[model samples]
Target: MPEREILALRQRNAELESRLAQRESDDNLYRFLFDTMDEGFCVIEFFDGPHGPLSDYVHLVANAAYARHAGIANVVGQKLREMVPDEADNWVARYGAVLRTGKPLQFEQELVATGRVLSVTTFRIEPAERRQVAVLFKDVTERRRAEDALQQLNDQLEQRVAEALAERGLFAELVENSVARVQVVDTELRLLAVNHRAVKDFEFLFGHRLKAGDSLPERLANFPAERARSEAMWRRALAGESYIETIEYGRGARLRHFELRFNPLRESSGRITGACLFIYDVTRQVDEQQRRLQAEEALRQAQKMEAVGQLTGGIAHDFNNLLGGMLGAQELLRQRLEQGRLAEIPALLDTAGHSARRAAALVHRLLAFSRRQTLLPQATAVGQLVKDMVVLIHRSVGPAISVQVQCDAQLWPSFIDPPQLESALLNLCINARDALPAGGMIDIKCDNRWLDDSTALALDLPCGPYLCLSVQDNGRGMTQEVQEKAIDPFFTTKPLGQGTGLGLSMAYGFVRQSGGQLQITSSPGAGTRVDLYLPRHGETPIARRPPSEAPAQVQRAAARILLVEDQAALRMVIGDVLEELGHSVERAEHGPAALELLESGYVPQLLISDIGLPAGLDGRQVAERCRARFADLPVLFITGYDQSAAQGDGRLPPRTQVLLKPFELPDLVDRVITLLG
Candidate 1:
């Protein structure tokens, strides 16, 4: 019995010893693993504390990593309240919940003691009644921050997408409701989008429906001209050019005027993407402008007709008055002769002669005012001419009115008739003298003026250099009303019969006819200033005036002459004068008769002819025919026309002389003798 019991006991002891040895080895490995783990690991045991039952914890087993993650050293067997007393309350979510639920809990929280965020997992250990839990955690501060940033980015992207959609909706609404036609096209002229108005207009104009994504060239293929025009404009806009232009569509009554605005679509980098066209109809505006222009033209025509009527009426009244004066004078002469008042014969003849001279002067002035008077323009030294006439002007104005003449140095030469200028000067002085009844001052001045476009327009003359002749008088000035009508025919400010009233009118017309301007500046109680703006001679070289010589006079004897005249009385009187002057005379009633007489071998030493001849030839033609037979024959023109017209705007031909009608008999004789001898 003792041998069997001893063997069983020995086997049991060997088994127990081996089991104890394996257990110790496993414990050592666990300890090594726990100490070397990267994550902080600890075993916490719950206990009753100041907070309440099972409300606090102590670290029963903590690895070396606990200090690295939790920033607390010597954690083994330490109460949480003792290790981190300040942050002990912050871990209220730990151990208690895991122990109650017996489930693993995962959470992230910042360890205020170390100022680091920790990701933590904790669970109740085996046999939960012992009130211990295992906690594993790692620092995750950077990872949590990145996750929060990602969430924010997702929210912002959603909001931006919503805004883009709203903007697109607004753009569509604006295009659909706009009155103008709109189309957006890419650089290749492919339509990206189009409004309803543009589609309708395209269909109406080109008889085809227009749609988005349609190539513009394809839509306008049937209309080659339209395609070319649209393409040209579209290319410019696609090249980043924005502009407004006008376009016409349809024809005649169906035509529409459209204002087109082009805009370019560009990218963020200023790269051109597309072009947009906005077209608005402006047909009504164009039609209105045309109607306004037509109305203006019609109004101008009506004004011209009214002006012509006034001028014609004035001419008839003045002409009849002048004719009556001449007729009355002639009737008185006849009565005196019938009564045989020999002593009064000379006085009656003087009266008739004076009336005749007045009639002639009236005709000349009327012609001047009408701007139909002939002009003989020559480059004249105006300053020298004014100086020469100062003595005459002073005499005409009289000693009571002091006349001051001042001319600018280096004055330009004016192209004008010297006699007419002299006559104009005398007329202006006389007017000034009349104004100066109380004997004021008269200032005659001349200077060169350069008129720019605006100044010339104000003066109603062409822009150029000019010579200004000014006549100023410090006398009783004309009122606004009087100055306005100063250039009108028969308008006068003087007492009855004292002034002809044609002074200003004649001067104004004459100046205008000579390519110049006449301006009057006057105000009541101030003074009157008349300025004559004459065109400067265009030639650069100053004209040197030759010394003037008197016409040569010859003895009136034994000179043969041929005369051609149209009027019966004038012809008879001229023939009698020629015979009395001891000249052989031949006469014809018209140019044809004169030519016929000349063809009959009647070649006289001198040819005298009237300008207003009948039968298809005037004095100029008669002279030509007469001179063909008698070369170098001296020809005398007796005409009512002024020398400006009789010579046809040029110097008279060789061996020619001109005498206007109503010229003195003695002057005529002198002319004739000079030509014949």
Candidate 2:
């Protein structure tokens, strides 16, 4: 056998031994990995079963981690039915597909018996004869739960986004379709949003187009006034001051009116970021109101003209009757005097005198109704005045009509003419009596009132305290037409000659002249009420001393009187009358002449002057000039003209008196006597 042959065989034997050792080592490593692997591993062998061919399988082998994942210990050599009989068919059908198709499959399933979830992978063993499948799985329940939760969160977020987009779209639509102009601006006055109406109106008003991101003021730059004003209002809104405004622009045919509402635009966190303006055109409404005001004014003017015409006609008729009476009486007296019938002359003279007195009385009432008569206003206790008249009223109205007087315990004092107020009260009472033809009740009420601004405005009087004296009668009352003209002079409901038509008019005038209002409230069959609201004098009145019933002393000392009359006839007549009264008289035709007499050291005890003089100075001026020299001179102003200044607000000089013209000689003498005393 040779040495070379021995070497070759020895080498081959060593190579075979090395290959066997390496194969054994690889087998041990594979076994160790299979047992300690975290994933559960198993092999299922299929076989013929009761359900049919290859209907079930048994666990041929399982790794150590198989029990932890599948919760089944000693799973090797266990049939699927024996291990989980309730769901054996389900497992067999799932793994049997791998054997029949020879395809690998991967899936996760719950092991109900162990209450564990297993992720399993299976494939058929290589040989068709060997019906087997291998599976690798892990308990993936926690991972599946986390993935489901993430998916739900993603769905909610998507839904929220969709809702937010829908809301924004709705808001935009609302603004665009609004009839009024709507715009939103940032703090920088930049246009953030604007509706179609706002854009169109802005173009119409300022002849400029509007768009988002454009500065509003810049668009109105050419119209400086509108720009400045609009910016001011916007700034206020931006500063958190919400307000409303009415604006008018243009003139005549181009005039337009608009109502604007401004509000601050705020974030959801309540931070003011900008402002919004809403504007509505109200040109038609404004024009209608203006037309209404014009129509009302025209109606007022027409009614005023109608009243004037009525007043004129009434005055002409009354004056003509008085004139005819006086003229007829004078003619009769002249004829009787020519015939030398002294007895008939006295009767004719009496007739003429009676006519003259009636004419004078008519003139005085006319003056009172016109609020032009002389007034010596002083604080008066009107409550006591009304109380004093109750007895007279009761007697005048007869026993048929019941008379009642009610006065406030703390009635406010009033500034008014005492004689005029008494005449007014008596006239009102007499008028009330006439209303109650079948005898009704007459209620007199006097109360204090504090007029607020609204009441004062309605009554056309200043707001303040007032004294209210009312006369109410339960009679037939008056219609609206009659009540409206009830206060008019010479307007009466009674038949001719029975009523003078001056009672209510005189009362109203007297109340008005004393800074008061006269209101008449009446309705058909609701009775009549006349309320006199005189301004409160704000002071307690002095107690009035009762007049003595005794006559004035006839035997009085002579007084030196200065007669400053513009009319020569009046001077002569007045001078002669003073002389007849045993008084010395000096005459002057004008104020300058009278002052000259006074300057020449002729100081008269009384100065009687006409208020409307012909020369440089009037009666008031003459008296003022005369008093400059003779500080204590007593003055008596005689006039038929308006002498409002001397008596207005009761501001007459001390020791001064006023007398209206057409006075009887006796009345003149009485006034002279009183002033001299």
Candidate 3:
């Protein structure tokens, strides 16, 4: 053995020892790095299987993180098929492709053993020929869940956006097609959008087309009168105010009206952005209102004129008939006196006086129908009044018609004019007679009634107790139209000259003036009924005096009487009558002369005066003056007019009596004798 060879061997041994120590140190550092990494690390070795090359793999190396993520311990030498049988083939195929192609592959998969999602990057181990793969992976279960949730949220958001766009499209369509003119403007008063109606209206008004971005004020410039108002409205809307107004345009048949509204448009931030204007045509509304008012006024005028004409004509016809009777009777009396027919004088005079009395009654009826007659209201028993008028009603209806009276046992009293009520009842009986040419039953019923709220509303009357006097007739019933106008003056259904038409009108007026209601019900085939609802009187009704057996013989008395009359013929006739009754008479043609005579100490036991004597002082004033001198003087008032003036304040002096004009001479004599007694 040589010494040099020994030395070379020792050196080689030292060098080999150094190289081995460096390799061991590098392997330890790599192992430490692999174990400390956050990502899971593993190395897989592939081999040929029954299917193909690189068909399966075995876990050759695994870091501590890989063990922790895979939820398996000691997995370094385990086959991928053994750990995750279901996914082993898939994983093997993926890693085999990377190993064979020398390409890196990234994918996400689930670990069945731990049920954790993993993001993996696979690459071939160092050498190209090596059928081995190194896997760098992370447990990304939480991140995957978050990404899935985000995707679902995005899908929902897309659906909501699509729905919102569809709704917006529908709203736009509705606005565009609306009948009302609609316009949208920017803050600068420039038009942004307009409905079809607005475009058409603008074109009609300005004779030009309108487009977006056109200034609203400029568009209205052609209508100078409306430009300022339109601008002001836009300004107000821009200031966040809303306004509405109505305006009229054009004239006559071409007239038009518009109701305009200006509304402020706002942004999501609640800031005023622009304005929206709406215009509605109101021409028909305005025209209809005007026409209705005009029609109502015209109807009122027509009703008023009809009432007046009817009243005038009725009064004239009635007066002429009455005057003719009186004039004819007087002419016959005059002829008898000229022929020296003394025996017929009394009968002729009675006939003339009767005609005059009839004329006075006609005047009274006229006044009653006009509602101008002074009525003496009293507590009148309705049942008694109806009973008393039964005979008169039967006479008026004639023998063909039967009259029946039905009254309550304890009938209520009515506050009304007794004479007027009797006249009204008589008129109703006559009307019923006229209705039935062939004849039918007439029924008069009187009863007490309590009107409730509903009843009062139906009758247009106050709620209270009332005395109901109903006159029903089973005769030729009136039609609806006739019933409606039955109470109108001179609205009779009778033939020409057969009916005066004032019967129902007079009764209606009398009943109404006494604070009552008159209701008539009838149909074409049904019977007619007239109901008079009179207000109940608080006081008890006074008992009426029975009829006298015969006229009492007048007792003769001598007394001086002052007679005041306006007409000379009447004064002389009355004076002669008073003298024939054994009373001295002092005559005066007028009120002043009568007063002068009385003032000159011509005192009398009674003062007889015409109520309507002409002059500065009326007959009533003269009588008052005479009474001052003679306190106990009796007064007898004779008048063709109403005695309301003489009965001032609804009362006359004590021992005062009123005798209507054209009274019988015997009745006059009897009154004078009774007053002088």
Clashes of each: 0, 0, 0
| RMSD (CA, Å), each prediction | 32.3, 31.7, 32.5
TM-score, every prediction: 0.36, 0.37, 0.38
Model 2: runs farther than 4 Å from truth?
1-169, 288-316, 325-466, 476-535, 539-677
Candidate 1: segments with Cα more than 4 A from true spot:
1-325, 368-528, 531-554
In terms of lDDT, which candidate is strongest? 2
RMSD of 2: 31.7
Better of 2 and 3 by lDDT: 2
lDDT (Cα atoms) of all candidates against the true structure: 0.73, 0.74, 0.73
Any idea what lDDT model 2 has?
Answer: 0.74
lDDT tens per residue, model 1, 1-677: 69889999999999999999776543433343345434577778889988888867878877776789888888887787776677776664566888887876767788776778777766566567888777777666655564464343221110001111223332343344344577878789998777777888788788998888999999999899999999999998988788989989999777889988887876546777677787876676577557655654454334223223334554455457667766776787788789886787666666666656655654554344333334567888889888866645655666699989999989888888766676677678778888898899999999989899999999988898999999999988899999889988557887774655666776787688889989999998898999999998965445433212223344456877888887889888888887876788888899888878877877789988988877899888888888788888999998776665567646789888988787667667778877876
Q: Which one wins on TM-score?
A: 3
- Candidate 1 residue-wise lDDT at 549: 26
Encode model 2's per-residue lDDT on 1-677: one tens digit a residue: 68899999999999999999776543433443345444677878998989899988888878887888887788898888888888988888888887888766667787777667666666565565788776766676654554464343221110001111223332343245444577778899998777777887777777888998999888988989988999999999989897899999877787889998888866546778788787877776566557655654454334333323334554566568778888998988888889888788767667776767666655654454344335678889999878755644665666799988889898888989975786677677777888888999999999989999999999999999999999999888899999888987567798865654667776787788899999999888888899999999976888623222222347789888999888889889889877876889999998889888877889788999988888778888888888888899888889884456456465778888877887666667777877777
